[model samples]
Target: MASVADNLTMALRKQIGAKLNVLLLRFFDQNKSGEILSRVTNDLDKITETLQTGLLKLLVAIGTIVGSLAVMFYYDVLLTIIFLVFMAICIIITRMLAGKNLKYAAFRQETLGTLTGIVEEYYTGRNVIKAYNHEKESMEQVCANTELNRKATQKADFLTNSVNPLIRLITRLSQAVIAVIAGTSMLKGTMSVGVVQAFFQYVNQTAEPLTQASYMINTIQSALASAERTFELLDSEEEIADTKTPVVLNRAKGTISFEHVSFGYDSSKLLMKDISFTVKPGQKIAVVGSTGAGKTTLINLLMRFYEVNSGKILVDGISSVDMTRQGLRQNFGMVLQDTWLFGGTIAENIAYGKPDATREEIVAAAKAAKVDYFIRTMPQGYDTMLDNEGGNLSVGQRQLLTIARVFLCNPPILILDEATSSVDTRTEKEINKAMQELMNGRTSFVIAHRLSTIRDADIILFMENGNIIEQGNHQELLIGNCETGLQA
Candidate 1:
C-alpha cells in the first residue's frame, strides 16, 4: 500500500498530468486542458461542498415559507392556498429544466475525451501524415473533431444558462398571482396589512432558494461529468505491480522460458496461444512475424507489460510474479521499435542505463556499440547535445546512441525490437557488428524484418495469427519453406 502522502501526490499528479497532457498533447484537446481542469477540480469541488450550502438555503427558505403561509391562512385559507399552488407549478418547471442541463453536461464530457484522443494520435503521427502528403486531410479531420467538441460544450452551457431565466420568469409570474389574490383578499377585509407584508417576504424567500437550488443542481451535474473522468483516471490500474517483499535480482543467469503461455490484450482475443519456448544463457533467438502476428506483443509480454491470460513465464527457475517489475527489468536492456532519446549529451545518454559508470566504462560501452568513433569526431564529442528529435544526429546515429545505452547497461538479457528496421544498409552493417558483440555472452531476443540479421540465429520462430506456424533454424526453414514464398 502506498503512503497517504504518496497517494495524495499521485492524485495531484494525475490531476496535473491530465491537464498538462491535455496541453502537451495539443492535437487531442479541442476544449483545452486548463478549462477541463477547472471544470474537474474547481467546479466539481464546489459541487461536492454545495450539499451543505443547498441544505442551509433550503432550511431558511422552508422556515420563511412556513411562517408566511401560517399568517396568510390565518387571514384567509383560499388566498393562501392560491400562493402555494402557484409555487408548486414553478418548482415543477425548474426541476425539468435542471435535468436537461445535467444531461447536456454529461454528453459534453464524452465528446471532450473523443476529441482529445483524436488530437493525440494525429500529432504523434504527424511525420507519417507528411510522408503521405495528407496534411490537409488530417487538418480537416481535426477541424471536424474540434467542431463537435465546441457544439457539445455549447449545448451544455446553453441548457444550464436557460435554468436561471426560466426560474426568474416562473418566480415573477407566481409573485404576480400572489399579489393579485392577496390584494383582493385584504380589500375584502379578510387579510390584514401585516399579513400581506409578511407573505411577500416569505414568497420571495421561497422562490429565491428554489431558484438558487436549480443553479446548484445544474452546477453539480456539470461537475459530476468532469469528476467522473478525473476519478476514472485516478482509479485506473498502474502499469507495474510490485509487492512489499519484492524479490531483488541485481544480476541474472538469463535462462527464460515461456511455458505453454497463452496471452492477449483481451481474453477473448488471444494474440499468442499454446506457445512454449526456452532461451538459455548466451543464446541468440530470432522471432519473425508479419505485422500484427504477435511479434511485438510477445516482447511486450516478456517485459510484463501485460499479464498472461494463462500459463506462466519463468526466469532463473522463479516465477515472474515472484519478482518485482523493477527487479525483472533490471537484468535486461531493451531498445524499442520507436527510438527514445531524451535531450542530453551523447555521453549522458550512453551513461543513463548505468548512471554510476566511470567515464572509461562509458567510452568502452560506446566503442562497443560503434557510437564512440562518431562522437569523438564531433565538435563536442561525447558532450554533444541532441535536441529537437535529435536533429543534430541522423536516424542511424540515434540508433547507435540507443545501442550505446544498451551496452552501458550490460544486462544479461538483451531485447531489440526492429532495431535495424529503419537504418540504411551501411549503418545496418555497423549496428549488426555491434549487435553481435552485445549478443556475445548473453541471452538475446531480436525482432527484425530484415532476414539477414537473424540468418545465424540458433532458432527462428515464424508466427501467423496467434500461433507459431513454423519453428526451426533459418537454414532449415528456408530450404523447407523456399517454395512456400516466405519473406523475412
Candidate 2:
C-alpha cells in the first residue's frame, strides 16, 4: 500500500494545478511559498508520526488503568472517585486549548504576509533610494515595519507558549493528588501492591500525550493561518475576464468615439461625467489642461484599462465591449507619464512584446526616436545591460527608448503623454520632425502642458474638471489668454 505521505503530496499537486490564476500567482511568488510548502509537508507528516506514537502510549495507559481498577474498585469507593476526578481535569485542560491555539497561529501568519509585502516593495525600489541618496530614510522605514512585525508575532506566540507550561503544571499536580489517594487506600489495606504500581504507570501514560499535544497545537495553528492568507489572495477578483469565445479585431482604421462616458475609482464620487467626444480617422487631437483635469482618465478609457461607468467607446463603430482587451490595445500604442524601462539590453527592450521584429526594424525604430545615437556611443552599443530600470541612461534617453518600443509596435492609434517633456528643445524638434512623419494616416492624441507643441495640432481641447470647456485649432485656445501674445 502507498504511504500516507504519497497520497497527501499527490492531492496537493492536483489542487495547486487546478486553479490557473492561483497557480500563476504562486509561480510569481518567490518568497515564503517554498517555506510554506515545506511546512505543510512537515506538519502533515508529523500528524501520522504523532498518531502512531500517541496511540501506543494511550493503549498502554488504558491497560494499566484497567489492571489497577479491577483491584481498586474493591477498595473504598471514595479512593476510586478521587483518582478519576483529577484525570477528568487534565482532559478538560487539553480540550479547551486545542481550538483557541489554532486561531492565534492564523493571525501570526497574516502579520508575516504584511511584512513580506513591505520588504518586496523596498527591494523593487532599492536603486531609487540609492540614486537619490534616500537610503537612510528607506532603511528606517524597513526597520520600523520589521519591528512592528516582530511585535505582532510575539503577541500571537504569547498564548501558544503559555499553554504548554500551564498544561504540564496541571498534569503534574493532578498526578500527585492521585498518588496520595492511592497510597492512603493501600495503608488501609484496601488496595493491593500490584494495583498501586499499575496506578502510577497509568498516570504517566495518560498525562504524557496531553502535555505533548499542547505544544503540538502551537505549530498546527501557525500552519493553518498561512493557508488562510494564501487562499484569500488566490480567491481575489482577477483583473480581466476570459471569454468563451473572444472577438477578433482584424484591422483598425483609428476612428474612436466616446458617447456620454463617466467613470470614478469610487462609485459614490464621479470623476468624469457624461463626457462625449469623437475622433475621425487620421485626426491629430491635442488634449490640453492643467494638472488633475482628467486628461489621463481620457487616455485610460481609450485603452480600456478601466471600464467606463456609463455610455460607450467605439472604434470604427464597433463597441469596445465587443473587442477583447488584448485586441483593443494591440491597435493603440501608448507612452505613459511614468517612463518605465525593463531590465535588459537596449535592443531587447525595444523589441518587448513584439518578439518577431527584424534587427533592421529595431535599429530603424531606435534611429527614428533618436535613441540609436546614444546606444551606439555606449560601451556595448545596443547590447548594453540596463539593470536598475535603465537608471544608467538619462531620463530623456529612457523616454526615447520607450518611444522606440511604440514605434516598433506601430499601432494605428498613438497616445503621447507629455512625450516631449524629457528631451531638450533641440532634441524635441528632431523628435517632432520624425513624429510628424510617423503620424501619417493615423489618429493621435497628445497630452501636453507645453504651449509650443499644440501649435501644430489640427484641433485643440481645453478641458477643466472633465468637461471640454474650450475647443478649437491651436490659435482658438491661445486667444483665450492661455497664449503669451495677442489673439488671432
Candidate 3:
C-alpha cells in the first residue's frame, strides 16, 4: 500500500512539474524559477513523505475503529454508550486543535519555499558575490532566511507533536471511565463478569486505531499544505493558446516587416511605440542604439518570445501570429551575447540543433566559426566533455561554439546579438569573416554597439529611448545625411 501510494504521488508530482515548467516558459516571470523549483522539489517531497504513511494508516485505523465499535455494541449496549461519550469529548478537543496544526504546517511550507529561493539565488550568484566582495552581505541574507525557516519548522513541529499526547490522555481517561462502568455492571448483575472483561478487551483494541489517527492527523495537515502549494503552480495561467490550425512555415525566405509595432513589459508604461521597419529577403540589418534603446526588445518581439501589443509582424508575407511558434522559430537561427552550452561532448553541443549531423558537418561548422583549431588542441578534441555551463572553455571559445551551432543550423533568417562581443581582436576578425559567410543569401539582424562590426551593414537603425529616430546605411548615418526626423 505504501509503495502504491508512493507511485501515485510521484506520478502526480511529475504531471504538475511538467505543467509548472510550461508555465515558467510561457507566462511566469523569470525571477520565480527558484520558487518554482522549491515547489517541484521540497514541497513535493513533503507531500510524498506524508502520503507514504498517512493514507494507509488512516484507512486501516478507521476500519479497525469501526469494527471494534460493532463488536463493543454487540457485547454490551450500556457500556458502549458510556465509551461513546468519551470518544465524542476526545473528538471535540481534536477538532479544536486541528485548525492550529494546519495553520503552522502551511507557514512552515511557505517559509521553506522562501528559504529555497534564497539558497538558489545565493549559489547562482556566488561568482558575483566574490567579484564584488559581498560575501558578508550574502551570508547575512542567507542566515536571515535560514533563521526564518527554522522558526517556522520549530513551531509546526511543536503543534504537530502536541496533538498525539493530548489524544493519548483522552484515551487513558476513556479507559478509566470504561473500567468503572464495567465494574458497576458486573456488581449490579445486569452483565456477566466475562462479558464485562470482553468489553474491556474491545476498548483496549480500539485505542490502537485512535492512536494511529492522532499520529496521522499531523501528517495529513502537512501533506495538504504541500499539495496546495503544488496545485497553485499547476493551476497558474497557461500560455496564450496557439491557433487550432496554425500555419506551419517551412523552407522560409526571411522577408520581415514590423508594421507600427508597439509593446511594453508593463501595460502601464509603454516601452516601444510606433516601431516600424522592413528588411529585404537577404539584407543585413544592423540594430545599433544606446543601452535601454529597446534593441533586444525588438528581437524579442520578432521571435515571438513576447507578443506585440498593438501591431503585427509579418514573416515573408504571412502574419507571424498565424504561424506555429515552433515552426516560426525553426526558420531562424540565433547566436546571443551570452553563450549557453549544456553538459555534453564538444561535438554534441555543436550538433545540438542538427542532432543527426555527421561528424564531418560538425567539424566543418567548427572550422567556419574559427574554433576548430582550439578543439583539436583539447585533450580529447571534439570528444572533450564540457562541464555544466561549459566551465572548461574560455568565454570567447564558448561564444564561438554557439556561433558554430548557428553555422550548422543555416536557417533562412539569423539573429546575432553581439556575437563577437567576448572574442579577442584577432578572433573577432576571424568570426566576422565566418559570420559574413553565414549571412550570405540570408536575412540577418545584427545587434551591436561597436561601430566597426556593423560598418558594412545594408541598413543601420539608430534608436533612442523607445523609438527609432534615424535609419540609413552606415555611411549615410556617419555623415548625418539621412532625412529622418532625428539626427544620428
Error of 1 at 195 (Å): 3.8
Candidate lDDT (C-alpha), each = 0.74, 0.72, 0.85
In candidate 2, stretches whose alpha carbon ends up further than 4 angstroms from where it belongs are 1-145, 180-203, 237-243, 475-488
lDDT of 2 by residue, 1-488 (tens): 12543564456445544543333332444445433443344433444444434445545655665665555556445655665676577557655665666665555554555555666676777888799998898888778867876876787667767766887788788778878877887899888778778666655665665565555555455545554554544464444564557677766898888899988756678888887778888888888877888888888888877777899999988888788878888988888767888889889999985889888999999999987988899999988999878989888988899889999988899999888788898888898888887788889999866566677777776677876766678766566665523132
Q: For every model shown, what is its TM-score relative to the native structure? A: 0.77, 0.75, 0.94
Q: Is candidate 1 or candidate 2 better by TM-score?
A: 1
Model 1 has a clash total of 3
**Candidate 3, which ten residues in sequence have the lowest lDDT sum?**
479-488
Prediction-by-prediction clash tally: 3, 1, 0
Where model 1 places Cα greater than 4 Å from the true spot, the runs are 1-87, 131-133, 188-191, 232-246, 289-292, 343-364, 373-393, 449-452, 469-488
Residue 86 in candidate 1 has what lDDT? 69
